[model samples]
Target chain A: MTGREPIIDIRNVSMRFDDTLVLDDISLSIANGEFLTFLGPSGCGKTTLLRLLAGFESPTSGDIFINGQRMNDVPPHRREVNTVFQSYALFPHMTVFENVAFGLRRKKLPASEIKGRVAEMLALVKLEGLGGRRPAQLSGGQQQRVALARAVVNRPLVLLLDEPLSALDFKLRTQMQMELKHLQRRLGITFVFVTHDQAEAFAMSDRVAVMSSGHITQRGTPQEIYENPQNLFVASFVGEINILDAVITGHAPDHLEATIEGRRGALHSRRDYPDGQRVKVLLRPEDLRLSRPEDPEAAEACFSGVIKECTYKGATVDIQVEIEGGKALQATEFFNEDSEDIDYRPGEPVRVSWVRGWETVLPDD
Target chain B: MIRIVKAAYVSLVYAFLYVPILVLVVFAFNDSRVATNWQGFSLRWFAKLFGNETLLGAAVNSVLVGVLAATLATAIGTLAAVAIYRYRFLGRKVLSTAVYILTIQPDIVMGISLLVLFMAVRMPLGFTTLLLAHVTFCIPFVTITVLGRLKGFDTHIVEAAQDLGASEYEIFLRIILPMILPAVAAGWLLSFTLSLDDVMVSFFVTGPSFEILPLKIYAMVKLGVKPEVNALSAILLVLTFCIVFAAQLMMKERREK
Candidate 1:
């Protein structure tokens, strides 16, 4: 991801709408042919950043570069970028063929060439024989494909997808996610996708930028963000997390000795903390292992808790545990077909512990 | 018993609306000049209507004004609707509200005001004044109609076009115009109908040299209700019906598409 000139560079970009700032000062770069996603809840400026890249909205401050050329003043039509809007935004008056051919016609390409290219694109999107149908005649997923084919048919330097699959049902959305990722790879075009769905972002993005309150809080690979969040917001937003209060008592060679939930435990951390420093420990739900309190191995380095409830998910069971100090934690255990002991009743006493060095420690925010 | 009452009420309403026009249509085919007595079915009044130079001239003038006023009003109003919908500027809200106000303004008040405006400018109250007055009244109707159509429009479609390398002009021409054409056509037809049948506004603004069909028919009826007048009224009614029918068909086709 280094040494190659970035296809897109957004430097110190800020956007304000009257009294509200939509995007704070932010800088990001995308490599050519790389798929990056801006993932956040609504009004987090993820869509605003995508719009800036598409040249629909200019930044109130700072500059945006596409293919090394500044795009602050350029109109969307002049810029080498295309967008698949959330609503699909297919032209209702035109057939699927004409909708895909719109940009090529705008470029004043020869009519025969336009026809052939449109047919090829239609075939690529698997809508070959349906080109004559109008947008209203097609189903939702077909409309989504038409939108995708329309934007990518232009073969622009950057393709911006503003939650293009959000309108689809769950199954279709999942299928489109895979198809979109494959299309991006096949076309070798830089894709800047915007969505609030963490799973969708993780599934398709080479890098994910988690945003909140108009600021990008963290940007990294999916595993990096899920396993190691920078703050509480990123930790809870990306996935389910168990945050526990811990007070550092001493430092070891590579780990810290801390009192967690009124129990002594080893805190694995990359950063150093002074003695008696207070911090928070982050753990994924699946990392916590639950055992019967009477078990000898569970007697040490564990927090005693009562099983509050058990939710039987198809692939896993979610166990809600109330720690002795009134802190509730969630633990997800995969379904074990051979074991009947996985079933736990409410009010049952249990001890919760995790593997050493599986926790992320951060200063309280 | 309830069904009978419902049918009677519906029939009564239709009769109340159409009885007068039905009388005129029936009289158009009357053999005698006397409107009260329908001697027999005849094409005599229809032939006389075509041969009367005064009525024919007025009919030509009315058609001319209707076409010209409708075209000009539609062009101006459609552009105004697009501007009000797409761009934000000072007084945009005020301008849109003003369009609605004009739509509800009484024709007599508009006619008198336009008359005063022409007098103040010392412009002759003839074809030019009549055309201007017709366009003025028709513009608000056109704008309101197009705006109604624009209410359901998706603005992201415009952005999508721009993202696909379409310029502002191309987006409007290729995307916006085609999408809103049914409304624009409806507005134009409405303007033409309004201009063709107008009596109050045209009464104040038009000069004696430029007589229109409605005013001419009014004058003819003042002397007496003649069979030729009935024939002319029936023809005008049919023309309006055809225009309205065409507009309905266009709107229905767009909806189905």
Candidate 2:
């Protein structure tokens, strides 16, 4: 993996279907053996981008180089890429063994080799003895495993999975996610997965490209994306965010005083914002706290507000506070001895705030 | 309230539609030479019908023409239906309209036009001519039946097969063919039934050298009502029911499986 060049290099690629511009000019480089995910909502062209990489569609005005060779006119059959579709797209007419053997047979590989490889793939996907059954005979998860084995038996340079786990139930999807991640690790081939599920994308990908409406909003490690999202879309898309519009009241060398709910505070940031500019601050639910206004010396912008709602979710508590400035701030706190006794019922006024710079201050919407 | 009304309407319409056929079927089993009154029930006319050599030969000719027509029509129509359904090309709308015209054309007009064209071209009017005309009439039936099924076909499955390294021909042969085969078989059987029972097209396209069962029955009806004719109609009815029922069973099994 270290010695080889990047497995796929997409340079300024754009695709359009008649009047619809499916994918805009985009460039991305994917390293070999890296688990990369294309994360986006519907109509984001993630599937189209995957098809372009698999040589199923031609990029309108750019180059797609696989293993350092430009592949534009090459058909999908000639390309070293296999796709596992969202529908699993299993051949309903063929048995599991036949479906997996289809590619090897196309290459005219020896019969012995074909059988051996299919058996090995089926075993890898943990469907070892189920090869003789048709797709309809198996459950959804089992059929999905067959689809994966069918695609991987070809030994593609990169495996393209288009929301392959979307159809499975929650428990099975979670189990398969772990299995797929491990399989990729063992195979050490570039795995470019596509899904709109944020948790699944974050769980499986080493880095993810979050696309919206045919353009990538942000591309980064899951941690980087969740912690330091570049803009409003990435911040809201990657995770649950409690956004607040705060005006800077004063600025210091290492901190700034801002008013969030008619409450002033010095926001200590390792970054900087102007003294008077209106900025939106993003606080992860867990980063917020509920306490009295007496702890102002140690706290940042403490809002004197009423606890309008409290949802007891076994391990953690979700509380919605009606803060000053006519805004409701949602926060989650862990169940501890202090929180257990404090029944901040509706209409009970409380100070809700967080430590300055506990969250990333995003650019204004 | 609406369901009751709809059921009543459907029953009345169906009774009106099938009253003639029911009359014919009942008369075939009456064993009486006259339709106004019933005599003793007997199987003697069925025995007598099987002994008519001229009627048997005409029955055999109609079967042969129907088989040939069904074979040719199903082959071309299924292919045309698949092509029209699967791919987009120039003049597709025009081609589709042409198919609609083929299905709706009156059999007598189609028969007369075919006769004049064949005669002007000096083509022989016999079994081959009758077969050709029947096949032309049946092509639209096959196309309509197959096209209905193809419309319900999951096209993504075909694309999936192709992506899984099956060549285009392999995809069709393995995936598309098996998926649509029951529809094709149904279409073939339907066309065969229509061609075998046809009178108008066969009337014009066939020369004196060849004759069909319907023409024979026509000639018999003109002369006098024969008990054997009713028996032959019973046999035809039974054969048609068997073919259609078997086709439907195959379809049901495919659906269940």
Candidate 3:
């Protein structure tokens, strides 16, 4: 995955469906043998981008390159890319073995070789001894495995997956996610996956690109995206966060001081910010800490609040605190059987605080 | 009492529909020359039907027209249905609506309109005109049946085929054609029966030279009731029932699969 040339380069691709812009000028590069995921909500153009790469659709503008060759005019059959469609799209009339062998037969391979390869692929997907069964007879998860085997049997240079697990149950989906990641590593093929589930993308991808309204708002590793999102949409879409409207009051070479509705707080940012600029301060739910009035470490940026709601989630108890200026901040505290901490009721008063560098400031939208 | 009344009503409906055909079939084997009296059971009328030169010639012409018109109609209708269902272009809605309209219009009106079309083009009302009219009307039936099958098709299956390195031509020959084959055969069978049983339309376009079986039966029936005509009608009924039965079987297999 490291120090390898990108196998698929999508350069400035834009797709318009009649009057609606489905994919804005999007550029992305997929490294060889790496699994990259396009994560977004429905109608966010992730599927459209995948289709453009698979040659199922031609972009309204720009070009695509695969293996250092321009593929603007390559038809889907001529391109060395295969897609596992969302519906599985296995020919209903064909058995599992026949479906897996379709591509091999299309290449005019000998009958004996086709049979061997198909049997090997079926075994790889752990669907051995089920070759004679048709798609209709298999369960949804089994059908999905067959679809994967069929596409992988073709030995495509890139495998494109368009929400192939969206149809499975949650438990099956989670199981398949691990299996798919393991298979991708073992096969060492470049995979471009499109999905709307952030947790699934984080679990399976080497890199994740978060898209919103036909544009990618952020692209990075899972940790970077979670800790450092570039925009408000990406921050909220990836996880839960509390956004505070703030104005920069003073600034120095390395840091800046900001006020949230007359409350003083010091903010640190790697990027430069001009003085008096308006911005939104972001705080993750787990980052905010709850304390009592007698705590000595409850220093600057502490807000006196009353607990409004508390929900125990087995592993952690989530408490929503209503602080000054009528703003609510949610804080999560993990359970510790060994510690001698007291749990507070709904109407108890408390203080909400975080460290100095815990906040992220972004330009107000 | 209510159950008995319900049974009586159902029996009455069945008898009303089947009695005339049953009489026609049974009287074909009547030895008497007159159909009003059944003197005995025999195969004399069937023998007379086979020996009649004029009726046999009409039967041959009808078979020729039915086979030719059915093949041509199925080919054109399958292509038209694929275009109407798969692609979006200018006037697509109107074209499909026109096909629907052709199916529902009265047969007399279509026969008259086709007669006018042939007359305006100065085409002689003979084999060519009859064949042309049959193909035109049969196309809509074939298209409608095929379109019904196409309604449930998942186009992504074709895309998946292309993804597996099947070219456009190969995909059509291997995937699309095989998937829709049952419906296509049903359409062809339906067209054949429609052409074979046609009388009103054939009466308008079929000239004196290219006599067909249906018109010959009509001409004979106009004279009087004859046992020979009964045998011919019985044979024609069996032929039509066989064709329609085959079509239903094809459609049933498609549904079950």
Worst 10 residues of 3 chain A by lDDT: A293-302
* DockQ for the candidates, in order: 0.83, 0.56, 0.70
How would the candidate models be sorted by lDDT, starting from the highest? Answer: 1, 3, 2
Best by DockQ: 1
The stretch of ten residues in a row with the least summed lDDT in candidate 1 chain A is A1-10
Which has the better DockQ: candidate 2, or candidate 3? 3
Cα error, residue A325 of model 1, in Å, equals 3.5
lDDT of 1 at B230: 88
Query: Considering every candidate listed, which one attains the maximal TM-score?
Result: 1
Give the per-residue lDDT of model 3 (tens digit) for A1-365.
54479999989999999999999999998899989999999999999999988898899999999988998889889899999999999988788998999888889999999998999899999999999998989999999999999999988999999999999999999999999999998989999999999889999999999999999889999889988889998888887899888888898666787787568877888776778889988899888888877776555435888999999898888889999899988888878899635387999888788766777888996
DockQ of predicted candidate 2: 0.56
Please write out the lDDT profile of model 1 over residues A35-140, one tens digit for every residue.
Answer: 9999999999999899888888899999999988999999999998899999999999999999999999999999999999999999999998999999999999
lDDT of 1 at B139: 97
Q: For candidate 3, lDDT tens digit of each residue in B84-159?
A: 8867899999999999999989999999999999999999899999999999999999999899888878878989
TM-score of each candidate structure, all chains considered together: 0.95, 0.92, 0.90
Sort the candidates on DockQ, descending order. 1, 3, 2
What is residue A17's positional error in candidate 2, in angstroms? 1.8
| Cα misplacement distance, residue B216 of candidate 3 (Å) | 2.3
lDDT of 2 by residue, A112-168 (tens): 999999999898889988988988899989989988999999998899999999999
